[model samples]
Target: MSVSKQADIAPTLRPPPALPADGMVISANFSVGGFSKRWNHCHQLANFLARYASANEDDPERHATLLSTFFNELLEAIYRNHGATGEIKMRFRKKQNHILVEAEVPINEQSAKFYNHAVQLANQPDPMAWYREQLEHDVPDDDAQALGLLELAVVYGSKLSISEPTSGDWLLLAIQFPFTEVEEL
Candidate 1:
């Protein structure tokens, strides 16, 4: 079964009162197996963030847009790999100052190749520029793509990082959204 982050904010977890802009905080995971294929986990998580992430009138819409991009693009990357393993794990976490979203999946030879290529493309000096260039010019035949990673960087201002191996060829991709810290009087 594929583990996925849920939209419901867990009861035990609590963060400081956000300035009406930060949305409710929660952490949950679901399986990504055949049964869960129809679910749009990303959108669920995104919408939750949209409603709760401290957002003003103007910011909510923008947050929704960015959150959508974040969820869609990350899922795109995972789907593009086309692996049979049904154990991918996706998470949405709120840190002291930022929201951390992540996805992890098992990698086969085909996915490993794609991962290497995509990582190389995404780790450029200016990832947004690279992503935009590819999006603007990417053809149907272009191999080894990571458009989702690019969109995450460009739209959400989330930094991408790979951590120590959790187990095997399981790849962990995480995006961190840092919130502005307002000093209190």
Candidate 2:
């Protein structure tokens, strides 16, 4: 092999140092450590959006728009209609480049049906727009049961995966949003 080729193929002994910030959340199902404890997952995610927007640092309106977009999806666990009372553990983690949000929601007999319906909608190619059409033209009272998953899939292009139950009734829905942070010039 040529000398130039050898240099190109050599392994990097030292990986790039992680960010100096030390922030993250620690939950049973989720833990975030990289930025700082002061900054929550939502904050981190919003920052990514702001960076992507290339907006001014102090621009409240830009930040608000981005935050709203992220918050709307984050509120899914709140309006979830379970058959019985159960706890859903939400996990938000900051990876090297992007943020990951997960929800471990319990699946009862009634909620299992909801899960099936949601899975179908989420897997559909045009779920979000289709649901909107249903609301606009056909059914005014469309429940929009799968809006969260649909938006995550359609908007952020997030890779969403649902894990099957292994030990208990809890179903794991994980959303990964890959982002690149803009360096300060």
Q: Which prediction has the highest lDDT against the true structure?
A: 1
**In candidate 1, which residue ranges exceed 4 Å CA deviation?**
1-24, 39-62, 136-144, 164-167, 178-185
Residue-wise lDDT of candidate 2 within 42-86, one digit each (tens)? 545545543433232244354445444654464443235332445
lDDT of 2 at 130: 71
Local accuracy of candidate 1 as per-residue lDDT tens digits, 1-185: 85666855466444544543333354434455641475556566556654555343334565555555566666667766645665777666666656677667666667766666666665678876766666687444433266666555665566777643746467776777654431110
Candidate 1 colliding pairs, count: 15
Candidate 2: where is the Cα deviation over 4 Å? Answer: 1-68, 126-132, 139-143, 181-185
Instruction: Indicate the residue-level lDDT of 128 in model 1.
Output: 69
What is the alpha-carbon lDDT of model 2 when measured against the actual structure?
0.52
After TM-score superposition, what is the CA distance of residue 136 in candidate 2 from its true location, in Å? 3.7
Reference-based lDDT, each prediction: 0.59, 0.52
Look at candidate 2 and tell me the lDDT of residue 73: 63
